[model samples]
Target: MNRAVIVAAKRTPIGKVGGILKDFEPDMLASFVIESLLHETKVSKEEINDVILGNVVGPGGNIARLAALTAGLPYHVPGVTVDRQCGSGLEAVNLAARLVQAGAGDIYLAGGVESTSRAPWKVEKPTSLYREAPHIFTRARFSTEEIGDPEMGEAAENVAEKYNISKDKQDLYSLKSHQKAVKAMESGRYLEELVPVHLLTRTGEKMVIAEDECPRKNTTIEKLSKLKPVFRENGTVTAGNACPINDGAALVLIMSERKCRELGLVPKLCFIDSAAAGVDPNFLGIGPVPAVTKLLNRTGLSMIDIDLVEFNEAFASQVLASLQLLNIPEEKVNVSGGALALGHPYGASGAVLVTRLMIEMKQKKARYGLATLGIGGGLGLASLFERIEE
Candidate 1:
């Protein structure tokens, strides 16, 4: 297989739901990031062979194709939209790498976008099984097992109970996440990859949302301790410890090493390996344990050799559990903070983390970085990148 290399990766500043970026639609937000990447890298739109987008909510549309068209790319450029829940963006990136490695495409764009503020409240439809047996639909609220369940928060609480993660530990981890995020923002370490998002205000005024809005700079452990659990009255997961609803878009340019050199583009990093794994749906948050272990074992590398790690913070308890199970060093993980502080934009989270990891690796002069995320449906995805010398 040909080595796939990342030429550039960038993301819009993550905005809280109903916050700075609420005015823009998901596709529009995704297009802005795609256009920014093209302009920043000076890469021609015609060079891209495909565009893959990940999205979790809203009416089904060819989001990838729409984003490319909106960004002024050729209509003929092939596009695909994928949904792996929180891992969608990373899955898109992984697919793009496979395409390049397989010699099917020389250049591709892969990423994800979500507008939780505008997420549609979809109504459950009668399942085929229900239709076949009309009496069943009347007897039960819904025919599908998928639709009759509780929200993700409840599922997270279930994981907490199963893993025996304590509420205090979760709160401590959540507090630490905010602290590290605030530190990173103060240090201006995220400026390289974060593109300022421009949007229209309610009064028809223009504004820019440049900084991550989820991180509570003033958050204290004492304040976190006082918060009540949201999913269950006595559950461990709380609003302060769980990922906030957010809006954002993120993308990366992937191409074969030979193709990048031919186009005179500097290779920022070469994709070394990628993997995905599955776990019990009820304990979806723990999916990353097996995923990262598989990737490390496949590549013959140990956790200590990894210079940087970006693990999505779905919930503080889940993040801590995954880290403990995987035996990852606490200091090296989420050096810029994870989704708990940065905001998880569902489909956009995986790509956002990948872009952030790349920027951190460049700044730290690190050789290797890993971007990983736990999905909502018992799935985990991970990608390994090796910094290429300029």
Candidate 2:
């Protein structure tokens, strides 16, 4: 029984799909963060017990190992990759903490990475003899056909309809998300934890991407109201309310509390506990309700006990529905914006939430922070962290 704590966290600026980060491969993006984390923490590669990462749609190899080697870590260090879809990154960090608590590792690097622009197009072998061509799949199935599977956007629409979340409310919430994110960016709230990404363009010029590409400083509700629904006919879900496909990577340095003391490093946040839950695929966006409930029950805490919440805003409708059901005030969630404004880089988004939660809890001088997100295929993952009193 050892305690696990997060001593450092860093992430690259999120880029819109086929935008600033499109040139970098998924492994390259991950390697940059790995190198930056090692440099920032001044931790030797030999001390790393393992490197774990979550990846959604990369070339089907163990990317954690690939990125670790690419970052020039010693060959002796091992790496493993996990895939829980959108929750992959947060789950990776949770796994690291559990390993630390079990006395299995002293120091670990865990997080997630995703490059929608670079993800390979998956093609399944043709099952019928009549069709020899391989069939393409945009994503993996969350459940079997018997249980019902819906597109992420369609699922959000279902939640909105079932929960009576209005289109106007969703648009208003989305507008505020953009406003808050723009404010945070302008005030340099995101600068300290962001790692600048360096790129070499096809024109042979060097470029450095240091700012997030998703936040819009001039977004307006009038503009949002004019947009048409994208998921269902007369549906409330729209591109304006849903997170855009994005590219980025985030990583955290986790170590046992004793190891932090030995290294003379003060941890910013202590890993309290984690929980996960499954729900009906049709209302996939409501996944966070049960997961957060389970977490509260396990920790003997309530929503009022949390000072800050970083719930992934996959869609304004889904976020609104889940928060309302959980009795979490809208003002306490995503105070500096969320995936709606920052963009959602699939596997990397969960780790990004945790990264924001840690930094924000420190800035606000808060005690408890919760990072949670609804998965694509009816799953939700939540992690609770307590800020260390300095």
Best by TM-score: 2
What TM-score does each of the candidates earn?
0.92, 0.98
Q: Write the per-residue lDDT of candidate 1 for residues 151-221, one digit (tens) a residue.
A: 57777888788778899999999889899999999999888888888767779988878898888989999
Relative to the true structure, candidate 2 reaches a TM of 0.98
Give the worst 10-residue stretch by lDDT in candidate 2: 125-134
Candidate 1: segments with Cα more than 4 A from true spot: 126-150
In model 2, how many backbone clashes occur?
Answer: 0
Error of 2 at 157 (Å): 0.6
Model 2 lDDT tens row, 95-175: 999999999999999999999999888888777966697789987898779988988998999999999998999999999
Clashing pairs in 2: none
Clashing pairs in 1: none
Instruction: Give the lowest summed-lDDT range of ten residues in model 1.
Output: 135-144
